[model samples]
Target: MADAASLPRPRRPVEMSGTNQSKRRTSRSWFSRPWASRPRTGGSWHAVAWIAVAACCLPLAGCKTWKKMTTSEKTLAEERTYGATADQRIDELAANAKKAKASSHADQVEFTQGLVKAMLDEHDPRVRCVILETAAEFETAAATAICKGALEDPDERVRMAGCTAWRKRGGAEAVELLAVRYRADPEIDVRLRALRELGDLGDREAVPVLATALEDSDPAVQYRAVGALKKVSGRDLGDDVNKWREWAADPDGSTAEWTIAEGFRQLF
Candidate 1:
């Protein structure tokens, strides 16, 4: 048995060394192929080209296309482009508002509401006038509030603009606000404007306010109040202040008479 074990040592024959040499040659051959030997140069170039192309296209896509804008966006863009300074911008908005009013363009009017509201704090009465004008175009609650606030502006022109806008966007609340302005506004012109708007509103609640306006110190206010009274009552009393006072003395009777007169006028 000892002799047999000693003989076994000679028979292994270095098979592992030969097998390892064969595997090394196979690996070398695989790496020597043209595709395998070349670094991925083309893929790197393609990636670089893609990056360059994206950089080139970025500027073109930076802003929204004109065709992509909605009606409101387009209008805002055009209006906002008019001026660099606040005053200039406000002037442009005013011009646009006048054009919109002339054309009866509701969309343009609506588009300017935000811009107008933003300028309410401007020190220039002209700018504020433009803001009120633009705001008055919309009959929305926000527009109502904006116009109502303008009534208290220190500038008479701004207060007058507020009255004008209030007339265009009249409601029960607007009627009450206008009546207050007509009675309490320090500027006679503002009061006159408010009185005219109140009459145009034709709210029965305005009857008392109009009657009080009849006694205003300014003859012009009295005259406009008489006209407003006619508008509200649907009767041409021809500036007879005493009769207006008489009618105002009885609110219930005045309202009833106005209602009957309005019914007849509408029927005819």
Candidate 2:
């Protein structure tokens, strides 16, 4: 222990005179002043950000929403609160569908039912498109039913998706579905998409659909039909609709277009 007198004294805090304080405040900017000397605030700004984040009012339990939506639905579901948007719900559905392959039969059935419900209840054209696309992953009859219904959906966007879904579920049936869409859709855009998918099919059945599209009233439709014919028929008619129509009128009469791959395939 040291002697008391040998111990160093604690210094008192400095006090400034009114004139000195005024001079110090005037000399320095608000931000330049020592942090301790600045005025203290409770940070109302922090609360403002929090309030903004929580401002979105959530709906009642029975109200329509994409995520965990009510089972009893007649009209399209409405937009949801934060973290529960229609897009987010669709993404979640797609993700869960990926895992559903490992799930039990009951779970798969439940998931499919929920997804189909979402498809029927969703009013957003983009959301409906996603639902139609999601349905393509499952080979269930219910899923197929919704996808078929999309072709006749009031929204052309959904109808366009219906064309794509059928293309993914390819076969003679897919060709037939696309052909129907091309022949009957009121919207020209949907008809164009149908022709595009039909060409992608590369099936013999699509040739007739493409040929019929060549005679459509819309020149754009006819032009698109010519492009599809080039792929489905594997022959370039020089983009002339008339020449393609002539060939389509008698497809078996024309020679096969030669390609390196086709030659090799023929050899094998």
Candidate 3:
């Protein structure tokens, strides 16, 4: 190390006054003297920014009151915003059905049925499903009529929706109608849906019709029918097993067929 005398001079001491005097010196601003002093807070840019942010947030905090809107007020706001949209109208109907409120002057049950019937005509499959599910809650004459008409809709989703609706509204006539679709619907998916709905209806009267589907050209339709028949009759239909096995081996058979056959095996 260098000798003390040759070492760098000690930094000149910053002789601060007493606390009050030192604070007074630091408090002197840009206009304090003939030669202006630098600002103590670097012009306070950060503080100014924080004050602006706080001012903005004070107004924004008032917006939190929107979350406390009553259900009726929320409904009114939604109606005002989305009134012209068909989707909004249908959603309103669904909400009303769940809340068991009438949406129109028509019979509450019939109004719900008509709304669901219209939804079955919608281009979106999910909308049709919602309509059917909500319609099932009505379970009145008009609700049944709408579901019956939906069975003939060109879209498989609409038809499946009808089937699900019918499942919830089970009666002798509903079972018969579903059985008819199980027998005569040209689309395999619709046929399968009808069979499933029939099984859920639990009417032994559907068993014969479903059993016929076990002979359908489409293995998926056949398997659905077998499963439905098993559920309806509560006894395994033994004669159909070999046919199911043959169907499972078919090169063109669907995975639905094999899976459904396995389900039947487990259930038995």
Best-performing candidate as measured by lDDT? 2
Worst 10 residues of 2 by lDDT: 73-82
Q: Give the whole-model CA lDDT for all candidates, comma-separated.
A: 0.74, 0.79, 0.69
| TM-score-superior candidate, 2 or 3 | 2
Candidate 3 lDDT tens digits, 1-268: 7899998897997766699676777667445744324663655776698999999997777566667788777777877886535677566766677555544435676566567557655776667667667666775666666677778877788787888888888888888888777767778777788889888788867756765676668778767776775576554534475653444344244622444457687889
Off by over 4 Å in 3: 1-90, 101-107, 113-123, 237-268
- Candidate 3, 135: how far from true, in Å? 1.7
lDDT per residue for candidate 2 within 56-151, as digits (tens), equals 444433333444645432223333223356766777777888887678877767777887788877877888888788878787777888888889
Considering TM-score, where higher is better, how would the candidates rank from best to worst? 2, 1, 3
Better of 1 and 3 by lDDT: 1
In candidate 1, what are the lDDT values of residues 73-160, reduced to their tens digit? 7767866885346665676777766676666556554655665557554766777787777777665556666777888888899888
Clashes of each: 0, 0, 0
Q: Specify the poorest-scoring 10-residue window by lDDT in model 3.
A: 248-257
Ranking by lDDT: 2, 1, 3
Error of model 3, residue 97, in angstroms: 1.4
